[model samples]
Target chain A: MLEQFGNFLVHGLVTGSMYAAVALGLTLTYGILGILNFAHGEMLMVGAYIAFVLTSRLGVNFLVAAVISMLAVGLLGWVIERTTFRFARHEHLNGLVISLGLVAILQNIALAIWGADPLSIPPPLPRTLEVWGIRIGEQRLLAFGLTVGLIILFSLFLKRTRLGKGIRATAQNAHVAATLGIRTERVVAVTFSLAAALAGLVGALIATIYTITPFMGGLPAMKGFVVMILGGLGSVGGSILAGFLVGVVESFGGGMISSIFKDGFGFVALILILIFRPWGLFGQRPEREDV
Target chain B: MARRSWQALPLVGLLAAGVLYPRLLPGDYFLHLGIVVSLYIILTSSLNLIMGITGQFAIAHAAFYGVGAYGSILLVTRLGVPYWWAWAAGILLAGIAALIIGASTLHLKGAYLAICTFAFSELFRLLLDNWISLTNGANGIIIRFVPPPIGIPGLFRFDLGSRRSYYYLMFTFALVTVWFVRRLARSDLGRVLGAIRQDETLALTAGFDTRRYKLLAFTVGSMYAGLAGATYAPYLSYIAPDLFDVNETIYIMMIMMIGGIRSIWGPVWGSILLVSLPQALDITPLLRMIAYGLVLILVMIRMPDGLAGFLDRLVSRLRPGGTWFGEKA
Candidate 1:
């Protein structure tokens, strides 16, 4: 029984890291810009597709393909923001409508290119090790390691770098940040690219674990939003904590309850949070209430 | 009232056109299209009540539409409830849902409310998808008989057997919904909603009861959606999860945005043109969606008021000396 529980723990940790990786970008974007990118997961989809194309069609090395896909998706994210979001950033409703439209546009473009079939790559690491009756696969370990590493790197970047400081300031108060000559637009654009790159990197990492399809982005994207909400929108620590918590809950829910309803838990939590705490788990309450 | 009667000439003409449409065009396909158009008219107009007029950004519309369709249809099918009574059940369930949901989430502004409602709708959709014992688990429920109209014996037995007749039935409801919304637009509540949309803080300061108005809009809007879905189940004779999905909600949003959020005719005309355009042009599904996305972006960026706004401008430009039927523009 102890061994079985250990296996569940390991499984949950693996899944949790991946969820955090995908959600990190989402929460950051929402926190800073006050705009939710509905098409954010499609960034993941685009990255995976690019990696698949490079490795499968063009015969590039898998590791190199991963890097290329991340950068490419980052560039795509930048272009999308510049074209669609830049003009409408101030108007929240317009930003939402534009983002929704972009979701449709990106999903369609991916569908047109990749079709609807599921795709996958051979695992980058083909070895498995047993740790106390809990077998560990190289692919899972690699995904977990990279996610943790990137998250740490991101936190450090926010802590030390000038641009990162600028992003944090903008998230706290875009108007004040601009008033201080922070170049808020550039910070926003950079933030979008960084978030997009993280999502893209995660897409490539997870492609080896799950089936890579044009529509693979939707569920993860929804879950990413869920994690962000759970963690409290814009709370980096909250996102990570909620990501792992969700993964464990999902792992147990799938193992103990029913797998079919596993997807529903996060959404259920989202509704409850909205009703009970619209601000989120770690978010600050609005200083002023209109009604 | 007499001056208002003269001002209502265009609306009367529209009502007459809707009434005469089936008679003039006797084609089954056209009549079928009419029912479809009416269904969208209901969807867009109700959505307008919340999103367009109230300025609440929400994405739970199709879920409400689904609840209405499933609620009424299940009553009629599973429990053998009377068809008309099932509609009441559906509308009631939808209104209750909106009331409970709106009350819970109304305090959250903008995307927070949107995400909350969206998640709630997803919950409803999942229940419909998984509760196989009840909802048939995505296989969906199919009903063969058209819902007969409810009335006293021998006084009226409505003919729902024919699509043309169904078109008239839809037309009557559609006309009524439009007129109802029009009346609401010019009423005290409508003005308050507009005020809330413009500036919720100021509206609150003015003691407008913003939450109550928002809740009212959300509940009434949901009821309209349920009514549309109840009408739709009979016309199509089948409904799967596909009929009421986020995509459907976005499509409705597109229709409302394209037509004119603030105008009654905007959604009506938008639905008419969009609903018939693909049928007329035979555009492929991918290209059609691309066009949808493109139009949404273009409209938001360039034409803030949508087609109605553009038309208002054109009419005003042409006849600077004359009032355009007491239109808001």
Candidate 2:
């Protein structure tokens, strides 16, 4: 029984890391731009598709494909910010609606290109590791490790880099950031690209573990949003913690209670959290004006 | 008196057109399309009440719709209840659901409210898909029994089994919905909703029970969706969990956005255009959806007010006084 528990725990952590990676991107974009990009999940889908095409079709190395996917999706994010979101930044609701339109566009474009069939790349590390009589897949371990390393590197980037400071400033107060000689537009673009890149990398990582489909991004995106809200929308630390918590909850719930309703657990948690603590675990109560 | 008579003329003409639509087409396919259009009209108009007029962004309209459909279907199929009673019960179930969801989540504004509603929708869909014994799992419920005809004693029996009769039934329901929504939009409640949408805090300061009003709008809006779904289940004869997902809600929203959210007739025009466009164009569903996305993005950027607003502008421009129906540009 304890060994079974360990397996579930390991499984939860691995899935949790992916959720955290996706949530990091979502939180960043929401923080800086103040618009919930409904199409954010589609970016993950696109990233996975790009990597899939490069590695499987063109015979590129998985690592090279992942990097290319990240950069390409990041560029797509920049263009999206400039073209669609830039015009909608002033109207919060309009921005959200525009993102919905983008979701339809991107999802359908993907469906057109890659049919509805689920696809997956050959796992770069297919070996299984046994530690203390507990078995773990190497690919899952690699995914978890890469996610943690990327998150740490990202945190350092935010803390140590000048552009990262600009992003922070812009997220705090765009008007003030602009007045302080920081180019707020540039900061917004870069933050959006970086967030998209994170989503892209996570997508590639997920592709290694799970089959890729046009609609694969929808649920994960919703879970990412759940994690973001659970962690307090703008708090990076909150998202990372909440991501794992949600993952474990979902994992244990599916394992013990009912696997069919596994996806429903996160939504249940989201609703309960919203009802009890609208502000989230680590988030400060937003100012009245912020709503 | 002259102006009042003149205003009534267009409404009368539109009513005549709707009543004669099936006869004029005389094709089963067109009648089928008519039924679908009417259903969407109900959906889009109700959604407009909440999202467009009240300015609350709830995307779970389809879940409420599903509730009505599934509730009524289950009753008719399982408990052997009469269709009309089951239908009313379904609408009530949807209203109750809205009451619960709205009371809990209405306090949140903007994206928070939107996401909460979305989560609720997903939860509802999950339940419908997983509750195997109750909802028949993912295989969906295929409705076999035909609804009995309704009439007063010996006056007139309107059979609902026929396609033409069902078409009229749905059309009449759609008409009632449109009329009720129009009345509500013009009533004192409508103005209050508009005020709340403009500024909830200001509405609170102005002595309006904003929360109560919002709850009322949401409940009523969702109930309209329920009505549509209840009527729709019998016509389609098959109901599935996947039929009422987030994408359907988004489609309803798209219709509202394209039609003109603030106007009563906007949904009418939007639903007609969107429902018929692909049919007329004969484009593949994939390309059609892509076009819809492109149009939605373009509309948001270029014409936020939607096609109805665009037409209103054009009419005002063409008129010498630069006003359409006495509403100022």
Candidate 3:
């Protein structure tokens, strides 16, 4: 029983890290852009596919391939912001709809190229660490470690970097940011690219643990949204806390309660949270604003 | 009066085409396509009431649709209830669901509401897929029993066993839905909904029970979606959890957006165009879906009002002071 509990904890942490990584991007983009990118998950899919091609097809190193994937996906994100989202930036609904459109386009394009079958890269680190009868995959540990490191690095960047200050300024008030000579557009582009890069890293990491598929992003994306809400829509720290909470809850729910409804736990939690605290656990009460 | 008659001419002609559709084509495939289109029209039109009119961004429409489909199918299959009764029950179930979901989440404006609704939709789908004993666990329930004929037995029984019958049934329902929506859009209720959509705070400040109106719109819209689903179950003769997922909801939303959300007639046009576009082009499903995505993005970016809005502009431009189709604005 203890062993099982430990295993579930490890599993939850691994999954939770991915959720955090994805939610970080989601929260960042939402904070800066003021629109939920419904297609954000597709970035993960695209990233994973890119890395898959680099490693599996091109025989590149996994870490190098992941970096390349992140850069490529970040560039894609910049292009998306410039082309599609830039046009509908004024209307939240239009942005949402456009993102949905991107989702379809990206998913279908992936489907056409990769087909419907799930693919997984051979684990770069195949060793399993067993401690007190609880075994944890090195890949899982690596993913969890990387996520924590990324979160720390991200916070430092936000706190210490000039560009990060510019991003925060833009997120606070685009009009003010622009008036202050911040180049709000550049900040938006940079934030989108950075968020996309985070998602891409998560995708590349996740590909090593789970089978990669075009549709793999959907569940994680949904979970990411749930986490984003739970973490207070724009709070970096809130997302980190909520991500683990959700992952643990989901793990236990699936392990103890029922596996068939495994994917449902996050949604149920989301609805319950929305009912009691619509503003989210960590989010401030939203002022009356046009959406 | 002269302009009114001229406008009615196209409507009359369209009605004539609808009535003569099965006969004009006389093929099972065409009939099938027509039924699908009609079903979509109902779905998209109903969605317009909430998203377009009431200004709620609930995307769990497919969940309500599935509830209706599954509710009716379960009743007919499990308890051996009459088809029509089951269908009615399905629609009622959908309404109740909408009421509950709307009551709880309607207070949340914008993206929060959208996410909440989306979560509900996924939850519903999960329930349908996981509750194996009840929903058969994604193997899906095949509807073996056909709906009994309507009208007087022996004198004139309109058997619903054929594609033509299903086509006409859906077509009639679609017409009724459009008419109902049109009426609602023109009525005080519609004006209130439009007001809410434009500015909820302003509407609330003006002594309108915005929540109640939003709930009403949501419930009514969901019921129609349920009606479409109930009808769809018998037509498809198979109901599955996957059929009513987020992708399906997105498709419905896309149809409404592409057709035009501002007017009732937008969905009617959108349904016809989107439903037939792929078939007409004879493209692969993948390529077709990609095209759909492109169209959705382009439409949202360029034509926020959709095809109906574009047509409205064109009509207003061609002849000043005369708006096309539904409302003046």
Candidate 4:
């Protein structure tokens, strides 16, 4: 029983870090842009597929391919922003709808290219470490370690760097940021890019743990959005915490109950949390709560 | 009176087209496509009332639809209930579910309400999947024949045992749904709902029961969706979670947006165009979804009011001060 408990904890944290990585991006984008990217998961899917192609077709090193995937998807995000979301910056409804459109388009394109089958690459480290009789995969450890490191680096970038501060300032008040000579458009675009990059990075890492598929991003995307809300839309720390919470809930709930309840359980917890705390665990009251 | 008759001229044309569609094509495939279009029109027009006219972005319409389809199908297969009675029961269950979901979540604001309803929808889908004893899990339930028991033995038993019969039934329901929505749009209730949709605070300030109206719109809209689903079960003869999942919900939203959300004819036009586009162009499934996404994004960005709205403007511009085909005043 104790061994199983430890195993579940280990699995949950690894899962939680993946959620956190994407949720961090989602929250940052929402904080700055006031729009949730419904197609964030497709970005993850695209990222994973890119990494897969780079490694298999071009024989790029796995880690190097992951990095390239991150950068490529981030650049793709910038293009998407300019084409689809620049005009829709102020229209939250349009942003949501457009994001969904992007999801459909991306998913269909991926399906066409890859077909509806799951694919996987051999793990970079293919070793398992047994700590106190609880076995953990090296791939999972590497993925979690990278996710945490990047998240910390991201937080610092948002705090200490000039561009990062510009982003936070814009997020705080776009009107004031614009008045203070900060190009809010650049901030929004950069944040969206970073978010997409983070999603891609997580996607590449997650592919190490599970098989990759064109449709794999949908569940994680839903969970990541739920985590964003659970942690509070704009709170980075809250999102991280909530990501773990979701992972733990899903892991333990699926272990104890039926596997089908994994996603369902996470949403149930979200609904309960919402009922009691509409603002979310870490979210501040949005200025316009009427809608 | 003559002016009023002229006002409904466009709708008359629409009615003629709808009635003549099966006759014009007459092939089984075309008739099947017509049934699918009719089903979508019934589904999305109700969605229009909740999201378009009432301004509530509830995404749980598909869940209610699932309830209707599953409920009616279960009653027929499990308990030997007649098809007509099962449909009523299914619609009632969906309405009740809507009432509960709407009452609890209606007071929340836009995105919050949307997510909350989404949660509800997801939860229902989950239950439908897990409750295998009742829902048959993800395998889904299949009803080979509709078994249209007229309830009166001697009143002439109409056998809905073929695709053609199912098509006619769906066509009739589609017409009824369109007619009902048109009447609702012109009624005081629709006007009040529209006002509330415009600004709930202002609507309430003007001494309106905003919550009641919103709930009414939600319940009625859900019932309409339920009716569509219940009718759809025997038409497809197969019911599964995929048919009523989040994807389906969003697809319904897409139809409403593409067809034009604010008008009754929007769903019909949207459904017809979208359902037939792949067939017409021989587009691959992947290419079709990509096109759908493009159209939806373009419409939302350039013409938030939709294709129906575009046509309404064109007609009004063509005939200034005239209610061409009963454009909403």
Candidate 5:
């Protein structure tokens, strides 16, 4: 039991990092746009499929495939933003409908292109590392290490750079940011592309850990939503923390209880938090518009 | 006075059509489809009372429906309670559950309320799936025997055994539900809910208890769903957790949106079109699901106001400020 507990924690951190990496984009979009991108999961699914195609068809290394996938998904996000989400009519409900429609379209496209069967991505490194009686797979360690490095880089980018500050400023108050000479549109566009890139990276990594399937994004997207709400809708820091927290809870909980309950935990936590806090763990009361 | 009578004519005609249509339609399959549509019409309209009218999104609507179904099914099968009493018991239990959930969560507005309600539905589903000793753990309890006779007692036994009778029963119930909502909409409570939906802070300043009204709408809407479920359990004769899923909630919202939200008969018209469309297609299962997804997306993108609202506007255009059924008295 002690050894398994140790194992659960190790596994949790790896899985949790991937979750945080992708869900961070969800946090940014929700904070700035206030629209739950229901297709966010499908974006990840697209990325994974891209990686699968790159490696299997082109015989590229997994890392190179991931980079290619990220660029492709980033381009897709740019296109989606310009075409679908750019229109400002009843944004929230309209975004929901459009994103949902996109989910179906993407899933069907994937089905047409790759079929419904699952595909696997071979690990970039074939070796495993053992330290202090802990067995760690090389691919998982690389994912974990990459995620931590990215988080640090992202934090630095957000804090130090002018573009990063502009994005943050827009998230805080788009009108004020625009008035202060920061182009809110550019900031929003950049944030959205960055988010898509992060989702693509996580998608590629996840494909290495698990099989790449068209339907894979649905569960993860729903779980990420639960995590985002729990951590507070727009708080990147909170999302990072809560992502790991959810992973640990799910890992240990699944190990203890049934696996079906794992998916239920994020939502359960969300409801409990909303009941008690309503503002979320780190969220502020959004200025009211209508009801 | 003549114009007012004209407005009444459509309502009267619709009720008359609803009553007579079952007899006019041939084949049991279409009748069965009619029953499902009517059931959804009730469900979607009841959901509209909370989401559309009150502006409080309650995705847990189906959870209340499931509670009603499970509550009555358990009472009838396990406790040996008669069907009539069991049905009432299920509705009451569901109503109470809704009341509690509403009181706790309805204070939240916007997406927060939606998230909370969604969580409750998920919780209910988990409990239903896990609680093996009671729900038989996904196997589902099959209701075997007919309850003791009701209505005409010995001579006119309530035979749930047949589909045709069930169809008429569901259609009549749906009509009564529409009438009830019509009355509610015209009431002062409806006005208050509308005000709250428009502006809660302003409504509070206007001396309206926005919280109370929101909760009231939630509970009442859920009660109607529960009642629908109570009757529905006997129709389906089986209860499962999937009936109360998030997708079902989304489907209800889509129907209401398509039907021209805030319109009284919008859900009924929308349900008739959307529900019957795929069944009429009669395609393979995988292609059918794909088709369903496409249909929903196309409707959302191109026809947001839905079929009924479009027709209503078209008729108005041709007639020039005239009513479809007749002019208001």
Candidate 6:
């Protein structure tokens, strides 16, 4: 019983950290832009596809392919913002519609380009390792490490950078930040691009762990959306906390109940949060009652 | 009353066209297409009630559609309930479901509400897919017969055995929904919803509990979608989870957006064009999705206000005294 429980804990952390990676970008974009980009998952899908193309088709190193995929997706996000989303800054629903459109377009584009075949990163890590009855795998450890490192790096970037400060300020008040000579548009664009890059990185990291299909992004993207809502939209801390919490629930739910029920937990959590505190676990209380 | 009669002319004409066009049409396929067009028009227009008039975005509109479909289908199938009562049950269940969701999440504004609705809809879709005992786990429950119309003993029995007849039935429902929404649009509630859309803070300060009004809008809008779905179940005789996915929700939103949200007839026109266009294309399903995506982007960029807005501009151009576009523009 002890050994099994210990195994669940380690596995949960591995999966949880990866979820945090995918969800981090969603939280940032929600914070900075105040619009949930429905296409964020497609960014992950795009990244995974790019990685697949580089490794399988072009035969690039896995690490290099992952980096390239991130940068490429980041550029795609910047272009999307510059052309379509720039006009929809203040109009919340317009942004949602545009992003939702982008989701359809991106998914279809992926389908057209890559077809529906599920791809995977070339196997590099040893399958598994047992340490005192707690089985650990090299791939799981690598994914967990990459997610942790990325999260830490992201925290530092947000904490100790001028651009990060601008992003934070814009999130707090775009108009006020603009009044203070902050380049709000540039900040918005940069933050969006950075968020896209983070999602892409997470996608590549998890590509090996899960089947990489063109439409695989939809489920995880929805889950990430649910996580963002459950943790409180735009709350970074809430996203991380909820990510791990969700992972644990999923781990236990999958173990105790069924895999399908594991996915249902996110929706259940969301409904409970919506019923009790719609603002989320760590989100700021709205000043206005109308919202 | 004289003014109201004149105001209803276009509606009368639409209903007349719906009834007569099947006779003039060349094929059953077009009639089938017309039925789909009218079904979507109902769905989109109802969605517009909240998104356009009340300025609330809901990604779970199709969930209510599914609920109504499933409710009526299950009632008619399992309990051998009468067709009309099954339809009524579906609508009621949809309204209740909407009320529950609205109560929980309507207070959250903008994106939060949108996300919550999206999540809930997805949850429902999952349940529909996984709840094998009840939903048959995605093989979908089938009905033996179409729900016959609820009416008198002999005078006006409805014929739903044919797709053309079903087209007329859905077309009637679509027209009624449009008329109801138009009435609401021009009424006090409509004015308040419009006011709330323009400035919620000001509306709130002006002694309006915007939340209550928004919830009412959400519930009413959901009820219309439910009615659409209830009608749809018997028409199609089958519904998988695929019918009520986020894609369908977005498709309805796109129809409303392209039609001109806040415009009474926008959704009707938008859905007609959108649903008809794909059928007219005669292409593979894969390319159809790609085309749908491209059309959404192109329509938004070219006609931001949608087909209704475009037509309104054209009408304004034709009439010298009318400056609806000018004032709004």
Interface CA root-mean-square deviation for model 6: 2.7
Against the true structure, what is model 1's DockQ? Answer: 0.53
Those runs of model 4 whose alpha carbons end farther than 4 Å from true positions after fitting are: A31-34, A286-291, B2-4, B149-159, B320-329
- Looking at model 6, the pairs that clash are none
The local lDDT score (0 to 100) that residue A48 gets in candidate 1 is: 87
Listed per candidate, the RMSD to the true structure in angstroms reads 2.8, 2.6, 2.5, 2.8, 3.5, 2.6
lDDT per model vs. reference: 0.82, 0.86, 0.86, 0.84, 0.78, 0.81
Q: Residue-wise lDDT of candidate 5 within B105-201, one digit each (tens)? A: 8877666677778878888888888888899867777766654434575654445667767776777778877767766876888888888888889
Model 5: lDDT of residue B117: 81
lDDT: worst 10-residue window of model 4 chain B:
B320-329
Give the distance in Å from residue A220's predicted Cα in candidate 2 to where it truly belongs. Answer: 1.4
Off by over 4 Å in 1: A288-290, B23-26, B150-158, B319-329
Q: Write the per-residue lDDT of candidate 4 for residues B1-329, one digit (tens) a residue.
A: 99789756666776788778878989988888988988998998889889888889888889999999999999999998987899899999999999998987887666666777888898988988899999898999878765564424875343577677777677778888887888898899989999998888888888998999999999999999999888888878899987898778888987877777777778887898879876776677788889878876888788666677777777889887654432541
RMSD of 3: 2.5
Which number leads on DockQ?
A: 3
Cα error, residue A279 of model 3, in Å, equals: 0.9
Model 1: residue A150 alpha-carbon error in angstroms: 1.7
- Compared with the true structure, what per-residue lDDT tens digits does model 3 show for residues B1-329? 99667745645665787998878888999998999999999999899888988889898999999999999999988999999999999999999999999999998866678888998999888888888899997899988888988867676455798878777778888988887887788788889999998888889888898889999999999999999999889879888999999879988987887888767788888999889988886788888888878888898888877788777788888888655653422
Worst 10 residues of 2 chain A by lDDT: A282-291
DockQ pick, better of 3 and 5: 3
How well is each residue in A93-211 modelled by candidate 6, as lDDT tens digits? Answer: 55666777787788877888878888788655858889989998888898788788888898788878998888888888999999999999899999889989988888887787788
How accurate locally is residue B80 in candidate 3, as Cα lDDT from 0 to 100?
A: 91
Docking band of candidate 2: medium
- As a TM-score, model 6 comes out at 0.93
Output the TM-score of candidate 5.
Answer: 0.89
